[model samples]
Target chain A: MRRPGPLALTCCDPLAAVTNATARIILICSGKGGVGKTTLTANLGIALAQLGQRTVVLDADFGLRNLDLLLGLENRIIYTAQELLAGSCRLEQALVKHKQQPNLALMPAGNPRMLEWLTPEDMRTVANLVAERADYVLIDCPAGVEQGFKNAAAACHEAIVITTPEMSAVRDADRVIGLLNSQGIQPIQLVLNRVRPRMVANQEMMSVADVTDLLALPLLGLVVEDEQVIVSTNRGEPLTLNGNGSPAARAYHNVARRLRGEQVPLHDPTRERRGLRARLLNKLGMAGN
Target chain B: MALFEFLQRLLGRQKPSGTLAKERLQLVLAHDRSDLNPELLEQMRREILEVVQKYVEIDLEEGDVSLETEDRVTALVANLPIKRARPAALTAPSD
Candidate 1:
């Protein structure tokens, strides 16, 4: 009998290569630290799950893993990715199920000292295993363009760069994008995080258009600065879960929908506050007349 | 404080923090992308001036060399005024 063709290969194909034609691997990377890469990864995983996509988040930052904490699954992590890879535990045993969302799960990072044992190829192997059981695999990459970044990005087919409006963040993002291009990662998207509309309106900050122009990549979405983010983080609940209709939560949902090929109008909802104020002023003027 | 800020804004002497950040980032990023630091650029300028001085007497008082950027491309541009032509022996055409 003739051997099965490449086209016949599926996620169920046990012989499929790591990062093969199985699932969409998205690496959330940022060159600068404290730019909300982990937060975006956690909330985005939930948002994707909410959209009916089975999502698995892999905290690739071995030394300083925070995805588990972001998802409020830190205390629940029984087995880490290191244990799974070492064959000490099965892949399912390593997955920490989301308490509220059945479709979402997380594979926490290994020990920092054990980071030396994991390579880019190893990351791809682990990602392939997790991707086999999920529709999407979002890897929370470590900050900077170091070994950790290489390991995180190795198994991914696409990348999403998160940056703030600060020139420092954008410059680092440009360098990161250049590095990603050199790595042969295609279809990289930009997430303008922590955008302040008041600053942008006053020409004090870079607008979405300015950022997109400099980076020259398709924008994934813009996440406005919201206080609810801190609240959700403090409670270990993702902002996408109990965001109570905050702009950041909606933006995350829209980003997930856009990932599923939905056309979302690119509008900054934070800017709507100004429009409302103008309408209120007009009403007050009419009433005065 | 408010009056001072108002005067600063009125005189156009106070640049918005955002604009300042953007301009500063642009300059730093251009230097970073080119992998050319200010010290290395200065050294290169000195060497270029030395080479040009051999061909003609340069107006060192006004000559300048700078790294200029257009769009995303960076170039080392040297602008030197000729004070006098060199001797025929120095600038003679090769056979």
Candidate 2:
């Protein structure tokens, strides 16, 4: 129950440390639906692990949970958080390891029939284990500011809001931000997701500057709408893993590095897309040279 | 100033969708957060108008007060029109 340093915040800081552990918990939330919160969570968990931190992606969406489906670990989860909470399994017994990444793990949500309710103590217990076990914990929160949302958020040290470059998402994010502020949680950052770079260049979408001005929040990451995201989601895999060289994959990795406290350059959305010949010409070392 | 002109010169500029959408979205969230319906606001306006009308000729439309809902508030703002006081009593005092 201790507060963290302004920018020097970590998951298990003395301020929030129950027993002097060093794990950091991050809750990824959105105020409204269909704003890419789940996708952001999957990629973020993968990104943090890729950045060399021991990370766990906790699916707190319960009842209608889908993180396992997104991570392609649905067929692999024999037990879930609900099972662990209900004493049917131990915490480590339920974790589904990533197929290729050894450092990352996925704690999937239970099936609908399990019907195990999560008490406040259960949330605290799970959050404590996150602090004890991993370097970072990324919990994928459900949409809406409801019980499920509160359940997921109560376990985190800080929050990252995922909003689309649209009004509804930003508005919901604004509400979530206001709530976080009231709860005395500081260092809340914003992530603008699914941006169309071409539209920004053409003035059809909101520029990053415009969104920052209106939202008046700390900017974390800006992800473009890459076709690779669709292909990866369709194939039930994280685009950050095993996806071929694509802009979205690169962007996810860059965000991952930034989350680990690196200085990754922000994309200039207003730049027009170059033609293939122009891209080739630039790659041939004449554009900057 | 140079950047301002460059942005202005960018042709066919539409209203920033994110800003506008955020505006409309925040407007609704204030009410949603508090579970207050629009009809409740109307009822309060009418009741407030009735209470004031009993004292003086309170303007209804031009003397409107409003309630604005944002992410953190349901603020009541009154844009009241003051009635002129018959030209300052026409002679200061009838001394």
Candidate 3:
């Protein structure tokens, strides 16, 4: 039998390029569920892809996986994390590449039973393997302080905590922040999702400043509460890709821009809403002055 | 609209919901970060009162034992004014 060439051996090695790879691993976590962690991950992945980044959103929530569903690629998932780890498929074969966005991909969770066997070390290996081919790997972490959270945070160098303006959400976020800080995760940022600016102005809902100050972390971005998010999500389309000129879409796109080291200003939907009203009134020649 | 705005402004002195939430969170999170739940704090207060009562007479109602944070450092500040010193026998140190 002829021996395989050195090139063939090296080509099949997934960890070969990991030594010199420089991928920014981000773990998107929340202490409370329904805070839009997976929604942010899917939208941010699409936004980063729009910025030409080779991004991979890893669904680290093993027992319950929804990233593929959010990305509208659940049916495209031929091989999962279990198959990849079982030596049945290559890493490239397991990654579900986005149809429209060539740069974005998803590494979905395996069978729920596999959650028991997956360790932090295994996650590190998978993350490192993908880091070789991708520029950014966003891990969608499960809620609460548990094994899934640990496994997700293990491979990530940076983290983003998502919370709403509610006290319970912020309290959970504070606990999650303490947990992430204990784990030595650096440069953790906050995303205030589902903000109602009018309510904030009327002193009903928490403001962005209030949340950031309470959480005591730098603000990454703020997503306004919009019906379009629900509609787009139900349609299995990321709001960033919808091109509907929604405030949440622009905010998510700005988040990706900020991640790319850009100095994009945070989008204020309330201000835009007022500005649009003024423009429409001016177009109709209604001069109150 | 202006009348409603005026009425809101007049009654705005009451604590807003967001501010109330913030205040509650500040207190609860300070305790949470220190790993001291209400139950634990209450238990600790009772134990501290028992220890202090053997040394000196004090009113538990007037005393205070709570958590406070300064520059991100948490401390369980306690204040228990002594009503009267214990007998010399109890105050005396055992060799």
Flag regions of model 2 displaced more than 4 Å. A1-20, A113-116, A201-203, A271-289, B1-23, B26-95
Clashing pairs in 3: none
Model 2, B20-85: lDDT tens digits are 554565456556555657899778878887655544464566976655653255677776565643
lDDT of 2: 0.69
The per-residue C-alpha lDDT of model 1 at residue B31 equals: 76
Q: Please say which candidate is ahead in TM-score: 2 or 3.
A: 3
Please provide TM-scores, in order, for all candidate models, with all chains considered together: 0.81, 0.72, 0.81
lDDT of 1 by residue, B1-95 (tens): 25575346445667555556766766676677678879998899999998888778999989999765445566777899999988964657676
Error of 2 at B89 (Å): 12
Candidate 1: tens digits of C-alpha lDDT, residues A185-289: 988998989998765654456767767766678998999988989989998999898757998899898889888899998887535544332344334442111
- Displacement of the residue A25 alpha carbon in candidate 3, Å: 0.8
lDDT of 3 by residue, B1-74 (tens): 24454244345434446667777887877888899778988999999998888788998789999897543467
Q: 2 or 3: which has the higher DockQ?
A: 3
Docking class of 1: acceptable
Off by more than 4 A, model 1: A1-20, A269-289, B1-3, B46-95
Q: Assess the local accuracy of residue A203 in candidate 1 as a C-alpha lDDT between 0 and 100.
A: 48
- Residue A3, candidate 2: C-alpha displacement in angstroms: 23
Q: Which one wins by TM-score: 1 or 2? A: 1
Instruction: Put down candidate 3 lDDT per residue, A1-289, tens digits, no spaces.
Output: 1212322343667665543368899999988999999999999999998888889999999978999988899899999877776767777788899988989999989999987788887787777766767899999998887888888888899999999999999989988888889889998988999998666654456777777767888889999888998888788889987667998888898899998899987765544443333344335444121
